[model samples]
Target: MNKQEYMNCAEEELLHTYNRFPVVLERGEGVYLYDTDGKKYLDFAAGIAVSAFGYGKKEYNDALKAQIDKVIHTSNLYYNTPVIEAAKKALAASGMDRIFFTNSGTEAIEGAMKAAKKYAYTRDGHAGHEIIAMNHAFHGRSLGALSITGTRHYQEPFEPLIPGVRFAEYNDLDSVKKQITEKTCAIFLETVQGEGGIYPAEKEFIEGIRKICDEHDILMVTDEIQCGMGRTGKMFAWQHYDVKPDIMTCAKAFGCGVPVGAFLMTEKAAEKSLVPGDHGTTYGGNPLVGAAVSTVFDLMEKENILEHVQEVAPYLEHALDALVEKYEFVSARRGLGLMQGLVLNVPVGKAAAKALEEGLIIITAGSDVLRFVPPLIIEKSHVDEMAEKLDKVFAQIEA
Candidate 1:
C-alpha cells in the first residue's frame, strides 16, 4: 500500500506510543531506505544507531535464516548453542566476567541497575543502594532506567520513580563527588551521552569517577547501548578513556536488526547477583537472537569493523565539522565516530522535518543538537554527498 494508507492503518491499529514521521519505509540497503512509493532517503540516523550492520547484509541474513530453520527459541532451561556463543563473544568483547541478556536497551539498563544496587545493597546493606547519574542523561524509558535518566522532561510525567538517584552535572567531577556520599551504590553514565547531545565524557572526568568509585566503593556502570558495538570507532567507548566499568549495559546494535539486550558485569558483581532466580527473561538468551549476535562478532572481527569505523567515521565527522564551520547556525559539533552531532542554534525538530522532506532521515538529541548515526558501512563518497546535501539544506533554512 501507499505511505498514507499504511500510516492511516497503523494509526488506527497500532499503539500510539511513537510520534512517527510521514515516511513509511518499505526496505533498506546499505545506508539508504526506500518508502512504499520507492522514494529513497539517506538513512543518516541508521534506525537510531541500531542498524550497525547496515540495511541488509548477506552474512546476517544467512545466519538468521539458518537459525530460523533449526530452532527459533528454547527456554532458558535448555542450553542453546548460539546463545552460549553469543555470551562468549559479548563477555570477551566487554572483558567482563558475566552477562544477563534481555530484549532491549531499556531492559539492559534495568538489569544493570538491579545488578549495581544489589551488588551494593547486599554487601553494605540496603541503606547504601543509591545511584549517581549525570544531568541530561538518557538511559531508557523503563521505571528503573527512567529513574536514573537525569532529564526531567522524560521523568516528570512518570513521577514517584525509584529513589536514591542523585543527579550530578555532566562532565563535572566535583558535582559527581559532592553527590556521591556513603549511601551511593553506583555511578551510572553513558560513555558518550547520546541523548544528552552526544557529549563524550572528559577523560579526566571519567578517571576521576573511576577513582571515586574505588575510594567510595561504588560501582561504576556505563551505558553503551547507543555508543558501543563499533558506533564509536571502538568495540566499547569506555576503552578510549583507559578505564573499565564495574558494569556495562549494551543493546540496540547488538543483535543487528533483531531485538535483544544484555547487561554485563565484573566477576565481583556477577558472583553476588545469584539469589536463586533473582532475575530472568523469557527471551533473554533466545537462540535466534543469539544466532544473529554470534554472526555479528564473526563479522566484526573478519571485516575489521572497528577499523572501518575508525577510517570512515573521520570523514563523517569532518563533513559535520565543515558544515559547522561554514554555517553560523551550527553552534557546536561533538561525539565520536559516526555518532556525531551538529548543534543547531535553533530548535532541531523543524530542521529534522526539513531534512526528511529533502529525502534524508536524521534525529535530534537534546533540543537543538541534531544527531547523525549513519550505518557503519557508509563510505567516504556517502559522507561527501550527505555533507553537500546538508550544506544545501542549511542554506535553505536561512532563506
Candidate 2:
C-alpha cells in the first residue's frame, strides 16, 4: 500500500490519540529517514530523541540478535544475566545505589513516586506526603505521572488525579520553597524541560533545590527521560550542575531504541523505601530490554558518545543562533547540548509541516518552539543539511 493508504488504514483501526504526521516512515538509516513514497528526510526529531545511536548500528543490532537467541524473558521471580549486567551498568552510570526497571518513562515516574512516599512513611510512620512539581513541566500521560504534570488542560479531563501534588514555578527557587511543608516528601522537575520548551535548569535554581532537599530531608526527583543518556553532553543533565538527585527517572535513550526505563536512587533513599513486594514488573528488565540497555551503555563508552555530542552541539547551536539573528520571526534559541529549540513568533506547527515537505523532520514543543533533538550520532554535515532545509522552511513561511 502507498503512504496515504497506510495512513488511512491506521486511522481506521487504531485509536485516535496522536495527530500523526502525513508521512508514513518506512525505515531509517543513520540520521535520515525514508517514507513509503521514497522521499528522504534529514531527521532532526530522532524519533523524539529515543534513537541515540541512530538507526541500524551494527554493534547494537548484533547484541540484540545474540540475546534473542539466548533468552527473551524470565519472570522477575528468576534472575537473568542480561538484567544483572544492565542493572550494574545503569547504577554505575547514574551513581545510584538501587534501581527499579520499568517498561516506560511513565512507569518509572510512578515507581519513583511510590518509593518517595514509602520513604516518608517509613520515616514518619504515616502517609499523605505531598510532592512539589514545577509548573509547565511535562512528566507523562499516565494517571500518577499526569497528576504531577503542572499543565492544567492535560489534567482537567482526568480530574481528581493522585492528589497532594503542588505546582511551583520552574527556575524560581523561592516559589518552590513556598510550596514546601512538613508533608512535602519529594520535589520533581525535568533537568531540561522537553515538552515545556527546551528550558535547561539554571545553575542557581537546581543547586538551590538540592540545598532545600538536603535541609528538609525531601527526596529530589528529576525526570531525565528526555535529557539523559548523553543527550546533554553528560551522562545525565543533572550532572552538568554537579547536583545529584535522590531519585532519578530515566528512559528515552536509556535503552537506545528498546522499551525500557528505570528509577534509580541513592543508598540513603534506598535504605528507607520500597522493600520487596512494594514494586514488581514482569517484563520491566527482561532479557530482551536488558540486552538493549546494557549494549547501549557499552556502546556509549566504546564510542565516546558523550564526547561526540559535546563536540557537535556547539556547531548546531551556532547554526541555530545564526538563524535567530537572520530571521525576524525567530526570537530565541535555548537548550543544552543536542536538545535545542527555537522560539518563534510564527506558528510552530505550520513551520514543522513545511520542513516535512522540504524532506526534513523537525518537531515542536510547547506552542511556539521548534524542537531539535536529532540523534546523538549526528555530525556537522547533518546539522548543515538541517539548517539549509530550515532556511527554506522559514522562507516559505515568510512568503
Candidate 3:
C-alpha cells in the first residue's frame, strides 16, 4: 500500500499515541529503508536502536526459522531449551548471576524496581522503600517505570505516581549524595543517558555513586536499555566505568529487533530478593524470543561487533565534530560509540523532519537534540552517506 493508504488505515484503526512520520517503510536492506512508493532512506535511527545487526542477517534469520519449526513458545511452568541456552549466554555476557526476561525494556525496568524494593523490604522492613533516579533519565512508559522517569512533562499527567521516588541531577555526585535517605532502596541511573540527550555518565560520578551505594548498602541499578548490547563498543555500558551495578536492565538491541528485555541481578541480590513468587511474566523468555536473543549474542561475538564499533566509532565522532565545526546551528555533540546526538540551536523536530524529506531517517531526543543511533553494522561508507545527507539538511536549515 501507498503512504496514504497506510496512514488511512492507521488513523481509522489505531490509537493516535504517536506523531508518526508520513513515510510508510515497506522493507529494509543493510542500512537503508524503502517506502512503498520506492523511495529510499538512510536509516540512522535503526528503529530507535533495535536493529543492531542491520536488516535480515542470515544467521539471525536461520536461527529464528529453525526455532519456529521446533517450538515457538512453551509455558514457563515447563523448562525449554531455548530459554535455558539464551539465559546462560546472556548471564555470561552481562556478568550477572540471575535473569528474568520481559517483553520490553519497560517491563524490565518494572521487574528491576520490584526486585530492588523487595530486597530492601527483606532486609529492613516494608515501611519506606524509596528509589533515587536521575533527573532527565528516561526509563520507560509503564506506570512503574514512568514514576521513576525524570522528565516532569511526561509524569505530570500521571501524578500520584509510585510514591517515594526522588530525582537527582545527572552526573552530579553531590546531588545524588544529598538525595539519599535511610529509606532509599535503590539508586537507578542510565550509565549513558539516551532519550534525555545522549549524555554519558562521567566516570568520576559513577565511581562516586558506587562508593556511596556500597557505603549505605544501597542497591545500584543501571538501565542499559539503549546503550547496552555492544552499542558503546562494550557488551554493557557499565563495563566502561569498571563498576558493576547490583542490578542491570537491558533491551532494545537485546534481540536485534525482537521484542525482548531482561533484568539481571548480582548474586547477593539474587539470593535475597524476588524469590519465585515475587515476580513473574507469561510470555517472557519463551522459546521464540529466546532464539532471537541467543542469535543476536552469537552473531555479535562471531562477527566481533565490539571491535568493529571500536574502529568505526572514532570516524563517526570525527564526522559529527566536523558538522559542529561547519554548522552555526549545531552547538554540541554528545554520547559514546554508535549512540550519539547533536545539540541544536533550533528545534530538533524541525531538523529531523527536513532530514526525512531529504531521504535521511533521523530522530530527536530531549526536544532540541538530533540523535543518531544507527545499526552496529554500519560502516564508514554509511557514515559518509549520513554526513552528506546531514550537510544538505543543515544547509536547508541555514537557508
Q: Estimate each model's TM-score.
A: 0.98, 0.99, 0.99
lDDT values for all models: 0.88, 0.95, 0.93
Question: Which 10 consecutive residues of model 2 have the lowest summed lDDT?
Answer: 25-34
After superposition, candidate 3 runs with Cα above 4 Å error: none
Question: In terms of TM-score, which candidate is stronger, 1 or 3?
Answer: 3
How far residue 257's Cα lies from its native spot in candidate 1, in Å, is 1.3
RMSD for each of the candidates: 1.2, 0.7, 0.8
Q: What is the C-alpha local distance difference test score of candidate 3? A: 0.93
What's the lDDT for residue 38 in model 2? 86
Candidate 2 regions exceeding 4 Å error are none
Task: List model 2 lDDT by residue over 1-399, tens digit each.
Answer: 988899999999999999998999998888889999889999999888999988979999999999999999898998999989999999998899999889999999999999999999998999999999999999999999999998899999998899899999999999999999999999999999999989999999999999999999999999999999999999999999999999999999999888999999999999999998889998899999999999999999999999999999999999999999999999999999999999999999999999999999999999899999999999999999999999999988888
Model 1 TM: 0.98
